[model samples]
Target: MRDNTRPLSPHLQVYRPQITSILSILHRMTGVTLALAALLLTYWLASAAYGPEAFGRAQVLLESWFGRLVLFGFTFSLFYHMCNGIRHLGWDMLWGFDMPRLRITGAIVVITSLSLTVLSWLMAYGHVGKL
Candidate 1:
């Protein structure tokens, strides 16, 4: 009998990654990160439901430097995921199929994600200064 098993496809080391691929991978990773962040949000809500003391401790934790870092990560992941999701929708609609358009949209997603993340943090910190 002849062996009919198909060989596996080439691995990632075979070729350099493109912007589109990087963005696609990041989109998936950010989704996972967002799920973790949701757990954190749930902890906060549960603390509130527990009592004043629990809520105060939770607030203190959330206001700490480590907590701030986690919040920033969560915020960036959310914005990146949202922007990439929109890009995926565009592709579903048969848009941005060409290399140039793909690159442009990839760049746009990165910039928009970063810009929105920064703007959101600024607003959160009340540093937006009357605007």
Candidate 2:
């Protein structure tokens, strides 16, 4: 009774990507990124507790260019997750369900996340005043 050549259900190839779906996916991906980044943070803290030599080695790794890149990604993922979570809160309140409002809010979430990430980095690097 089943056709092997046909999909069992509608799938990715059957639908065009939409903002809602894309944002939802990114929200999940960012959550995973944050979880992994937390492990890195734990390693840094544990290294400090282990001793100065361990701490210094951790610092050298964290301060390297690749480390900075990972840190930057973690920062962006953090902001993105936070902003999207707030958007979900709004949705839970029965807000922004209209297509136009959904689009606008999604854009707002992305722009705010990127702006916050840049500002945080600037502050971290002492390029901006302490908040």
Candidate 3:
């Protein structure tokens, strides 16, 4: 029983974006990104298990510039997902529902994700000492 007379709901173009909406969308997208990264990780592991020839090919591909870019994006997605998940857990417990707190927490999640991602890359590049 569809109502043909009723107006359709507004699309994305019709709405002003808010922090909560942005974070919510990013959380979902990051989850999917993380899943893809997991498959890449599994492929690398399988290649290693298949011995030198397969492992070398996997390593070579992963060491390329394009691969490094993908890896960097993967790292960012991982941290963002993790931080945002924690925020979600808090919400599940009925916390930070108010607008001000939501804004602060959303900013925190963004900062934490970026910081962790940068730190991870630094360590990977041997820029971080004894850490």
Question: Per-residue CA lDDT of candidate 1, range 1-131, in tens?
Answer: 86668656545567689787778779989999999999999999999999999999998998899999999999999999999899899999999899999999889989999999999988877863665
> What RMSD does model 3 have?
3.2
**Each candidate: what lDDT?**
0.90, 0.93, 0.92
Looking at candidate 2, what is the lDDT of residue 30?
A: 96
| Candidate 1 vs candidate 3, lDDT winner | 3
Higher-TM-score candidate of 1 and 3: 3
What ranking emerges by lDDT with the best candidate at the front? 2, 3, 1
Off by over 4 Å in 3: 1-11, 127-131
Q: Candidate 3 — which pairs collide? A: none
lDDT of 2 by residue, 48-77 (tens): 999999999999998899999999999999
lDDT of 3 by residue, 3-93 (tens): 8989785455676898888898899899999999999999999999999999999989988999999999999999999999999999999
lDDT of 2: 0.93
Can you tell me which runs of candidate 2 are displaced by over 4 Å?
Answer: 1-10, 127-131
Q: Lowest summed lDDT over 10 consecutive residues: which window, candidate 1?
A: 6-15
| Candidate 2 vs. true structure, TM-score | 0.86
